[model samples]
Target: MLWPNATRVLSKMGLLARLAAHCDSNTHFLVRTSSGKVLMKIALGDFDVPAICVRRADLLAALLSALPSEQILLGHEFRHLEQSGERVRIHFADGTSKEHDAVIGADGIRSRVRQTLFGKSDPIYRGYLIWRGVARYEGNAIEPGANSESWGAGKRFGILAIGEGKFTWYATLNTLADHSDSPDGRKSEIQKEFAGWHAPISNLVDATPDEEILKHLAYDNIPLRRWGVGRVTLLGDAAHPCTPNLGQGGCMALEDALVLAKCIVNHNSIQAGLRRYGSLRYSRTRHIQQRSLLMGHIGQWKNPLVVGGRRVVTNLLPARIFEHNLRRVYSYELPGS
Candidate 1:
């Protein structure tokens, strides 16, 4: 859903055909994994989340207008250069020369765009790692024929049904004092952390082949005062990388696209629009990032004392607080929405 504005922008420029979604049942996807037969069930916010599926190729296919020209480039390295006004200069690896009316850094974490604009900063590691995988469900896992994730002390779990028989599950566990970047080491670490967990939890791990299980050290970046300078701006993780605890990183990006497009429409020049985009998006995104990091830290506490304290306070936290907090983020209607 978030990719719509970008697709719409390209389509308006005659760079794409059409941008659409698969809300109907006819839409389908195929995953060629050896995880036996895949059946998935996903529950979000304690409710079944209807899937609005879209294939990556289909999305790209709509943008076939640019296929002939090949003007679009990938794998270009971000090379920083000095800039004038509120804008900055950046170079690509191919030595190709061009400057955007405004540069928006949507790059993911380990963002070269963020570092280029602001010097390197250390990530706030939340004392845990997330290991995830997709597998075929054996049926009867979900009573309502849905997917769900369970939260436990010092651990967390997720189940996402991706149509057909496939389900994606992720497990979060507190890591040891020293966690390595190696995939195997992280996998082993999760196994040790969740050794005495629920059966389904261990089953997912056992089913996930070595390569299939992806280990990601959980880290979230802090908020920054400046997200843009004139013609250059940052978006998504480049500006504020939030922890997955909120599952709002992509949602925030979707909002960013809409707001940016609207700001561009309102402002006379791309520079003004970029600045306005940054001005408007900075605070909101930063709040989410900071809050999510705090949530992850609390959710994945390594100390039993802290875990027990959290459990006690969990009941005291009002239901309205949870709903209201999430509403502030999700139910927001962008000016252009």
Candidate 2:
């Protein structure tokens, strides 16, 4: 279910098999509250999603390595953008400029490319901090390929297997936005905050290498009513940034890449292609963005009574409802070949 078109495209390029060799094909996901009781359990493979997790660096490296050298330009920090008639001029920090028929702003949340078009679309913080890292699995109740997320009072923790015995772990804390500390300091804070949470929570945090831990403030941007103008277009976080609650940031970006390519290939000109791409993508991305925000809000509920109610509701909910929603999410397939 994950990477439907992406798998095909990589397979065509003879890279899917190579990538699959190292990726984590999770078959199920388990959800729990801080009380150590299972709240929800989902069988991912039942929905036909074979592969679930990919190491970010590995995927990016593989894609870049597959591309021809001449097609890539590295280390040129994007400075600004200028549009003159039919061409868009890209200015780099290294004092170089280039013009192209179209520009795709996949530059991320703090995108200079997006800033040129929509001035100061800074991401709004959602009053949470996320500490994430990959740690060696050390005898947790959860098995490999079985993703798990546990919710606590205004906090949450996740475990997803990447490959081998390594698990990608993330913990969220509800706090003032933009507050941060040194890596060592953040690591200490996380350990203290989740000290008494549950079994695997402490085990994972304690096992993580101090240097490998990362801390980031969770933030998301408002979706643009329109994604582009003229020959310039936006993709990924530049167009629709959402909180990580739904784990669809990378998935949505991959979808964007495919649709953008399809639109361009089907259109006669760059402008038409960009417009069509926006038309096809805007609504879906907006829906996901709003849904992700809502999910984050719900997941971060601080009141114990509310959290208990959530657990009750989750327990009482029919499995079919979960299946239907997941089916809708995984049902997205690229239009035509």
Candidate 3:
């Protein structure tokens, strides 16, 4: 994803350092087994890639606050959309309507805007769900620059430092679709599910407050045959939702926002801009989405033998190979950046 723009925007607003100070700059990506044995440890520091972790809400609020108040809308539930001539009209659930030269639907995975454009397409569930939460730990419980993911049979847990003495953690489990679990129910279930896992896996779950826990089933759209139709277009997850396996879902959307803006500014017409944006983004986004899905499948292997084989293969691979793979993803920059 194009992060330089975000860095520039936040820097201009004097919030970049503040955000950096709060986020963990983890320089290692560790893949471990359920027994707490490290299978692969990729030294991200060698790649010179700066990993920034921020709670999505915090980042959004910071960005929104940086925008001019008069230019931003607070709350409105989008209901429907209509196109007339070169303009697209968006109708709000409250009966309000607005028109624009182009409409960029960024309403997320369950996007009403996407439905308005694509006619009620639903996301495909990936037969697993993730429980996420942030826990406050004592000094360096999850060290800064040490991000780890432990894969178990049909389950996985990840811990990464998000802030000083604060680590954001997630656990994924194979499950039936739409478990309909309440917050408390999910907390209890996750705790039980990860009970026998290594230290800090259990500890993080135990430390997280009930209200802070979040649970959701993983879902992604089948690669869309098209991103936009006319003056109406899509962005972010609305355009290409992907499994969280690669942790690039949000970054991909940020990349989309950057490229979309550049395409529009450089194009002669709105339609041309939308076309350029889709053309530039479709292949890259589709590739990442497919890779993420594949990684999820591998990471969630239920068979002990297969899981062991995966670990052995991962461990045997030279560190440079892992670094090369990561560089392919992280080294991407906006066309002229």
Candidate 4:
């Protein structure tokens, strides 16, 4: 999910137009009960920039297409690194090494670069597993540009239209970590879990092929006190990994790339630039991480009384109050923009 802030960043990078062609511009967001009753609705069109939903592969292809092929080296697994004065040398598993002015670790959640900089600490599991799939679903329930998430006891499901009659759906359930399903049983398991939730949910699952369904146990790391040391710095999930509750994990990475580049170009030295980048980003990213965790906890509530209260609170929430919080997130501008 590309929120307004991330879309604005993509526009600055000159990739928004290309991606917009194949993505769906979501105009509204709805929070509903498992029985399909709406508890809250927010008009996403009120924001200055539109929120979009695209297939992950499509978004990745757009990013890679904008870069020169030769500059992108694939199959070079990072092992460790050494920093000497102004130069940082990165060693790969293939026994090859390269020296650069600095190193930026965008290698994702289990980043080797991050481990080498800071001590190794495993990501904490959040006691939930998520199943995601995309299907060519056409129905009145899946209105164009409309996104919805339904909450049930200890479970939640989300649906997003990704243009061209394709919908991306995800279901999360409270479960133990490190659980796996048989290769052919994934689709059946998900269908059983979300059975009789709402219209089009079962339909979506049934429409998706068994091989297309993917399962993952949710995990996130505690926000690091510092994102970098010397000539090495981290970006995206490597710096501050968060749950997908708010759909900002990837968006934060996009914002980081832009800020890091600008900070480097504006500073006199690489160290100073990285320091400034961390300082500028720390507070905002930490706040997001905490909030996402809290949301996940609340969404996973299983008690009958607590779930009732949650629904009431959401239904009674003033539109302005909710809009105010969303505006703070979506209206963010790059420093000096």
Best by lDDT: 4
Q: Across residues 1-337, which tens digit of lDDT does each residue of candidate 2 receive? A: 2343345545545666767786677766778877578788876534323454667777788778888999988898988887889899989999999999899999997877888887887889999988998877758577666777899889999888877777788999899975767455766888888887877777788788777888888899888888888889999999998898878777788888878898999889889999989888888888889888998998899999998899899878765666566556666666642
Task: Estimate, for each residue in 81-178, the C-alpha lDDT of model 4 and write its tens digit.
Answer: 99998899999999999999999999988988899999898999998988999998877887666799999989999998888888889999998886
* lDDT (tens digit, per residue) of candidate 3 on 1-337: 1133344434545667766766766678888888788888888644333467788887788777767889878588898888999888889978899998888899898888778777888899999998999887774345557889999989999988876777889999998995777555767888788887877887788888877889888899888868898997888899899999888888788778778888889988989888888888889889889989998999888998998899899889887887776667776666631
TM-score of each: 0.74, 0.93, 0.91, 0.96
What is the C-alpha local distance difference test score of each model? 0.61, 0.79, 0.80, 0.88
Better of 2 and 4 by TM-score: 4
lDDT digits (tens) for residues 1-337 of candidate 1: 2223233344344533333333222112211111212222112232112223233355456546546656667677776755766445668777754555567888777777778778898666767778877666565643333434455667777665544555567777777636665555645656776676544556666667767777777777778778876677787777778778766676577568778888989988887787788788887888888788877876676577775566556545544555456546544545541
Deviation from native of the Cα of residue 140 in model 4, angstroms: 1.0
Q: Provide the lowest-lDDT 10-residue window in model 3.
A: 1-10
Query: What is the Cα-based TM-score of model 4?
Result: 0.96
Ranking by lDDT: 4, 3, 2, 1
lDDT of 4 at 171: 95
Better of 2 and 4 by lDDT: 4
Please report, as a residue range, the 10-residue window in candidate 2 with the lowest summed lDDT: 1-10
Question: What is the lDDT for 309 in model 2?
Answer: 91
